[model samples]
Target: MTGMRILAVAGGYPGWRAQALRALAAGWPPDAVTWTESDALPASAAGQMTLDYAPAPPAQTCAVAEPAAPVPAAPVRISRDFAALLQHAALYRSTQRWALLYRALWRWQNGDRSVASAADHDGARLHAMAKAVRRARHDMIAYVRFQQRAGGGMPEYLAWYEPGHDVLASAAEHFARRMGKSSWWIGTPHGSALWDGQAMHLSGLPADPAAMPATADQVEPLWLAYYQSIFNPARLNEAALVQHMPVRFWKGLPEGPLIPAMIAQARAGARRVGQAAAVGEMPGKPVPMEAGRAQPPRALPSTLDQCRRCELWRHATQAVPGCGPQGARIMLVGEQPGDQEDLAGQPFIGPAGQVLDDALRRAELARETVYLTNAVKHFKWVARGKRRMHKTPGQREVEACAAWLEEEIARVKPRVIVALGATALRAVLRRAAALQDHLDAPVLRGDALVMATYHPSYALRVQGVRTPAQVAAHIAETLARARQLAEATLPA
Candidate 1:
C-alpha cells in the first residue's frame, strides 16, 4: 500500500481514530492519502490504486500490523479540551473531514500545542463546526414532537425528524431520561433510535407511516389552539421569531401551517386587538366544582409555627399568630395576615393596622385591652408583575386553619367577639353567616357574644353601600357597641 492509498472509514471519530493510528504507525503523512466516507467514492483523484489497511476495532488505539519484525506501539498524548472538540467536529458532515482531523492530530502529536487553538486557521473552522453541531443538538431536543403510537406496540410513542447533523444517538438520551420506562421511537433519514424501556438501539430503519398519526392524541389540537390564541399581533416580531425557530423546522410542527396565515392577517389588521378574538371566547376547560381532596397524612404539626395543614405555609414568610394579653375581655377577629403582617409574625401591622388604630381611637377603646387575631394564620397571595398581590383564601384553606382560631378563642375567653368580616363570621360560628344581614345584631357562639361588621381594611377601598370615611365611622361605632357589651356582660 504505497502510492495514493485510499482510506475507507465506517463513520466519524472511533472508526477513523483506529485506522489513523495504524496509518501513523506505518509512517503515513496527512497529505499522503485521500480520506473518504465508506459510502462515497471520489473519481477525480489519480492513484496507483493502492488500498489502506482493513477496518480497525472500536477502541481508540492503533491495530498492530503482523509484520515479520513487529514494532512496539507508542502512546500519543492530547489535552482533554482538544479531545472534546474533535468528538464534536466528527458530527459535522464533510468530504474532507477525516483528512482535516488527521492533520490536526499529527501536528499536535509533534508538539504544536497551538494547532488546537482558535488563532490557527484550522482551529477556527473546527470551532465553528462544533458550534453548529451544538446548535443542531439543541434544535432536535426542542423541536421533536412525539405522537402516541396508533396501536400501542412495544414503543408507546413515535416521532419523525430531520436533523442536519448526525446527532440522533446523542439527542435520543434526553428523551430517554425524560420519558422514563415509556418506550419511544425517533426515526430520521440518516438513522433511527428505538428505546425499548431498558436500553436504546440504533439502526437504519425508516419510520412507519401507519404507526404515526398527523395529530398525536388530543393534545396537539389543544396545543395549537393555545399557541394561536396567545400570539399577540401587537407583540409579534417576525424577524426575531424566525431567527430563533428557523423556517426549515416549521414544516414538521402542528401549528406550522397557521403561522403564515397569522402573519398575513397581522399585516392586514395593522397589529390591532381586532385580528384575534378575546381568549374568553375560545373554548377552555371548566373549573372543577367542589373538587374533593385527600386528607393530609397527619394532622397539623405540633406547633402553629410549623403547621403544614395547607400549602399556604409554603410561600408565606412566616405564620402571623394572635397577639395580645392572654385573657383580654374583647377579641377582634379579622380575615388573615397581609404582606407586612406576614413578615413581622405579629397581627395588625400593615395598611389594615392603621385603619384599626383610627377606629380604636374614635371608639374611645384602648388597643392593648382587645385581643387581635385572624381566621387564617398565613398570608395568601398571587404574584402580579414584581409584587405579591393579596388573594382570598379558599373554603378548604379556611377549614384547615380552623383549629388555630379555636385554640386562640379558648385561650382568650373573651366576653365579646367582634367578627370583622364574613371570613371571621364563618370561622367563628362554623357556618355560612352573612355579614351584611347580621350587622346590627349579636349572635351567641359557645360562651361569647359574636358581633359582625366591615373589616378594617374595607376602609381602604370604595364600597357600593358606603364611602371609605363612612366605612371607618361605622367600624368605630361597631367597636364601641362591642366594648359596652363586654363591660356589661362579664363572667364572675
Candidate 2:
C-alpha cells in the first residue's frame, strides 16, 4: 500500500456501506484505506475499488466477528453501540465522515475501548454528528404533515419533508409503525419512502416538491385553529420555538406560515386587554348603574364559579375569589392564583402568601385589614410531565377578569390600593406601564391612591438588594407607607 487504496460504495444505504467498511477495515490497515461515497468520487478515479456491497446482517449475527486473528495480535472488537453510532454518523453530509469513522474503528481494534467517550476528540466529533442525525430524524417525524389525497379505496396520504441529514430511510420505520393501516408516502429532497400498510420501500431518486398535490386537507383549518388557541402570548419565546422546529422545515409545515401573524395578533391582543381594562368596558358587559340595583357583594363568591370570561377556567380546579372583609380599608392585589391557591380555592395561601403574611406581621398590619385578591382569578398553566408549570396570564385574560376586580373595588372602596406586581399594576392602571416607574412614589388613579410594590413572590426571588431580613424590612416600609396613605385619604 504505497499510496492510499481508495474504496467507494454506492450511497443512500448506511447498512450497505457499513458492511463494505467493516470488510475493508478487517483486512487492510485503516491508514491505507480511503473510503468515499460513490456519488462523491470524481469521474477520473476509475481505478479505485468499487466494492460490491450488501446490507449488513441482523444485529445479533453481526454483533462480533473475530476472523483468524490478524498478524498484529490486536483483534477488531466491535460492540452494538459502536456499530450503531458509526452507522448514524455515516449519514452526516460531511466529506471527511468516512475517514473519521475508519480512524475511530482502527482505535477500537488497537485496544482503545474508550474511543467513544466524549473526552476523546474523535468521540466528541462522532457524538455531535450522531446528534445531528438523530435531530434530523426527529424533525422528519414531527413536522411531516400528511395530506390526505382524494381517492376512493385505501385512502392514500402524501407528505413532503426536507431533512438536513440522510435520515429518510432511517426514519421510515417510525412512519410505517405509526400509520400501520394507512398507505402513505413521505418524500424528501434526497429520497422518498412509501409504506403500503405492510411493507416499506425506499428510493434514492430525489422528490420534486412541485409534483406533490397543493390541495389542503379538510382538517387543516381545525388544526390551525387549535394551534392558534394554545399559543400563549405571555410565554412566547421565539428563539426556543425556532430551535426545536428549525425555520428550514417551515415550508412543509401547515402551521409555519401562520406563526408570524399569530405572534403579531398575540401582541396586539395583549395591548387591547390592557386598554380594555383601563376603560370601563372590560368583560364586555354594560355596568348597571341604578341605585340599590347592584348584586349583593356577598353573592360574588358563588357567582365566580360560573365565570367563563377566559380560557383559564377550562384548566383551573376552581376560581379562587378574593378573601377578605367587604369593607376593608386596604386592598392588596396580586397577579394570579398559583398551583396551591388554585387547588385550595383560596387566595394568598401559597408560599408567596406565607411571605405576605410574614411581611404583614412585621409591618404591624393585620391580614384581616386588607382585601387580598389577584388580577386574574383563575390559574393559567401548562403541564410539564407530572407537574403543572405556571404560565403568566396574557393581557386578554386580565381584561376578561377585570369586571370581577372592578366589582371588588366598588364593594370595598379601599382608600389605598396596593398593586403587588406588574400584572396587578396593569389591572389597576388599565394600561401597560412599568412597575419601576411607580415604585418610588404613589400615583392617584381616580378616587384611589394607587401604590406599586414588589409582589411577595418577587421579594422571595430577590437574590441581591439585601438579605431575607432586608426583604422583610423593605416590605414593612412599603406597607407602613400604604397604611399612612390609607388613613390620610379616608373621608378626609
Candidate 3:
C-alpha cells in the first residue's frame, strides 16, 4: 500500500481485458493493484492515467506505473463460456465488480475450480450479474421502438431508451441486422448508439434522453389499430404485463398510452369477459347454436358462404352450395366437396364428381333430376407440397355443418337421401355411426330414407380396397336404390 499503482482503463470490455491480462502477466496479485476508469489513458496498464468516472474507486496515483513485471505468471486459462460470461458481467455498474471479477479469476487460475461453479459464493455472484446483464440486453432489444423521421443529417429512424444496464452498444447490433441497412439512433441517459448503415458509433452519456428529437412513426396509427384489434380483453393479465414490461419503459412506447385505457375497459364488468372492444363493435349475428333459441333461420343457400358456424369456411374458396333442381325426390349428399368443387364453387365436380356423374348416368338417373350436395360444403384440406390433400373434417366441423345439411333435405323434399360417406352419415342422422355399419343399409330420418355408402373419392385413393370400377358400381347401385325407394314411397 506504500507505493501501489492504480491501473486506469478507458472503459468498456477492451479496456478492462487489457488491464486484467497485464495484471495477471505481471504476477501482481489482485490485492496488489487497483482499477479505475480514465479519460486520460496512459500508454499501457504500466503507465500513469487520470481517473475519469470508472464507477469504481477514485485513483490515488501521481504519474506511477502499476508494478514491475516480476517474470510473467503462467498463462491462466478459462472456459470459452466463462470468458464470455466475464465480458457480460463486466458491464454491470457496481463499484466492487472489478475486485469481484479479479478474485474469481485468481481463484479459478489457482486450481480452485469451484470459483467457476454457481454453487460457490463468488461463482454465484458472477453468474447472477451476467444473467442480469443478458436480461437487460434482451429488454433493450425487445422494447426499443424506432420511429422513422424526415431526413436532415438525422438517421432514417430514431428512438429513446433507458435500459437498467449498459447494454445499448451490444443491443444496437440486433436492430442493424433486422432493419437491414437502415440508419438509426438510440439515445439513453447513460449512453447513445447510432448505426450509419455500414457501421455503428457508440458514445458515453447523452445530454438528455428527453432531448432526443424525432417524429412519431407514420405507420403508428395503423399499428395501434392492429394492436387494438388483437388485444383480447378476456385474456388480459395486468400483473404479467407489468412484470414483463416495466412501467419505467411505458413512457417510451408508442402504444403505452393505449394499454392502460384498454386494460381499464377490460376490467369493467361484462367487458372483461369478451373479445377485443373493437371486434365486439363489429356487425355480425351470433351463429345460431340452439334451434329453439335462435332467430328464424336465414335462407340457407343465400347465407351458407357467410357461415361462421365453423372455422372451416376460412380456408375454403367459397361454400360449395347444393346444386341441381330443387324439389327433386332424391338428394345425394356426399362428404365435403373435393378440390375442384371447392375452387369451382360447385358440388360434385372433381374426380370424385366425375365418378358420381358416370354413376348417376348408369343408374338411369339424370344429374338435373336429383339434388346433389355435400354434408360439409367447405373443402377441408392440408397442404402437401403444392397440392391440398384432403383432411377429414373433425367432429366439431361435421356438427357445425349439420344445420345446413338438414335445411338442404327439407328444401329438396328428398324421399331418399344418400349419405355418400361417414361424414354424410354423421351430418344427416346427427349421430356417430361408422360408414361400414350403415353402408348398403337405409335408415329413416323424418320423411327421408337416408342411405350410406363409400364416397366417390374412396376410389381415387391410391391402392384402395375398392377399385375405380367397383366404386362407380357401388355409387350407381346406391343411386338406383334411392330412386327405387323414392318411387315406392309414394306421397299420402
Candidate 4:
C-alpha cells in the first residue's frame, strides 16, 4: 500500500482519537494507517527513506499491549539434600546469594563458576534503564507549550511543542484546581493536554498546521491593554522590557497596537529629560541685596491670640501664645501641643513645662522672668481610637507655623535662646543640627546665643533606664549658665 505516512505522539495517559491528527489524515493516501505509541518517529517514504527516517524511541518506557499468551505459574522443585544444606547455611540463597558469593571468593580473580556476577550486573543495568525511562516520560509531560485559540464561546490555549518529559497530567490538575471553570489546551510534539473545564485529556499530535485552531481574540486585546497601562512613560526601558518579555511573546500579545505610540512618546520624553539635566548643570543667578543687609523688624507678640491655620485651632481650647515681658533677657523654645497645652492652649503648662517650672524654682529663677513659647503655634495630631496621638509636623507644616514663632522672637528680642531638643532647635534656628554635634554646645544666631539641651520628654521616656532626678539636675545647671549669660548680655 502506498500513502503519505503520518505519526502521532502524546504525553501522560492517552485519550480518544486526536482531532488534529484525523483532520491532517483526510488528504493523505487511502492506505495510510495511524499508529499511536510513546516513541518519537521521523517522516520518511518507503523507497526514499533517509538517515533521519530511523527515529529511535523517546527515552521513556511505554505501556503497549501486544497479543501473547500468558505464562503459567510453575511450582518450585528442590532436592531434600540441597534444602537441608540451605537451612543450615548462614545466608539464604534467595535473598543473600550475592553476599554469600562475595564472602566465599575474596581472592584476586577468584573464578567461582557461578552466574551470580553476571546476574547482578544485569539486574543493576535493568534498574537504571527503568529509572531513566520513568524520568524521561515525566519530563516529556512537563515541558510542552501550547498556543491559545478561541472556539465554542470559550477561549483556550492550543499550540504544539515537543516536550522533553511527562509533566502534563500534574500541570493540568494544578490549573484545574485553581481555575475550575476555565478551559485550556496544551499541544506537544508528542501529544496534547486538554481541559474541558471539568477533566483533562491527553492525545496525539496533529500533522498539519491548518488543523490547529485559530489564535484567541480576547487574549490579545486584554494583554495589550494591561501592557499599555503599566508602560510607565517616565521610565520606559525598551531594552529591559524586550529582555524580560521577548519578541516571541509579542506575537501572542496586543503589543503591536501600542508599539508606535510608545516609540513616539519615548523619544519626546528622552529630549525633555536631557534638557532638564542641562538646566540643572548651569549655575544659578544671584539675587541683589537690599540692606545689614536692611534688617526687617520682628513682629513679636507677648500673648497668643487670633491664631488659626491648622486643625489644632478646632480642638485646642485656646491658642497658647508666648508668655513673658517684652525684651526678656532669656527665651525658651519647645515642641508644640502637649495634652495639657492642647487643653489649656498654652505652652509650658504640660508635664514637660511643669518639670521646667520645678527646675526653675529649684534654681532660684522666677517662673514669669523668662520668655516661654512653642516652636509651632498649632497642635498636630493623628486620631488613635479615642485618644489623639501627637504627630510631628512635616517640613511644610513647620514652615507654615514659623510666622507665629518669628513674631514671638521679634517681640522678645532676648539676649539668649534656649532650644529644648532637636525639634525646638530646628524651629527657632530654621535649620536642623545633629544632636551629637550640638548637644551641650550652643550655636550663635546673629546676636542671640542659642543653647541646646535634651527635651523634657526625652528625659521622661528614659526615666526608668536613667535617673530623671539626674536629668533634671543637669537641665537646671544648663539653665543656670543660660541665666548668667542673659544677665551679663542684657542686664535688666
| All candidates: TM-score | 0.52, 0.51, 0.52, 0.37
Name the regions of candidate 3 deviating beyond 4 angstroms: 3-5, 39-72, 151-153, 210-212, 270-272, 275-492
User: RMSD to the native, candidate 2?
Assistant: 20.7
Q: How many backbone clashes does candidate 1 have?
A: 0
Report the C-alpha displacement of residue 223, candidate 1, in angstroms. 0.8
Write the residue-wise lDDT of candidate 4 on 295-396 in tens digits.
Answer: 565454344443434445555445567788888988888877676666554577767887898778776778788988877776777789988777776667
Q: State, as a TM-score between 0 and 1, how close model 2 is to the true structure.
A: 0.51
Answer with 1 or 2, whichever has the higher lDDT: 1
lDDT tens string, model 2, 1-492? Answer: 223445565654454356445554455555556666767666655444333334444434332334443645444558999888888888887778877887787787767878888779999999899999998888888888888765534438888887888888878898888877798888887888888898888888898766656455866755664575466665667789888877888877888899888668657775455455447443566776866667334333348866766778778777889989888878999999998887767789888999889888877899988999999999999999999888889999999899899989999988889998889999998999899898867888778888888888876677865676666666677888888877774442
The pairs that clash in candidate 3 are: none
Q: Top model by TM-score, which number?
A: 1
Better of 1 and 4 by lDDT: 1
Q: Which stretch of 10 consecutive residues in model 3 shows the poorest summed lDDT?
A: 50-59
- Model 3 residue 320 CA deviation in Å: 30
RMSD of 3: 15.3
Query: In order, what lDDT does every prediction score?
Result: 0.82, 0.77, 0.77, 0.56
lDDT of 3 by residue, 252-347 (tens): 788889998998887785264465544756899768587766647554445885577777866766678898788899888888887777766678
Q: Rank the candidate models, highest lDDT first.
A: 1, 3, 2, 4
Assess the local accuracy of residue 23 in candidate 4 as a C-alpha lDDT between 0 and 100.
19
Worst 10 residues of 4 by lDDT: 101-110
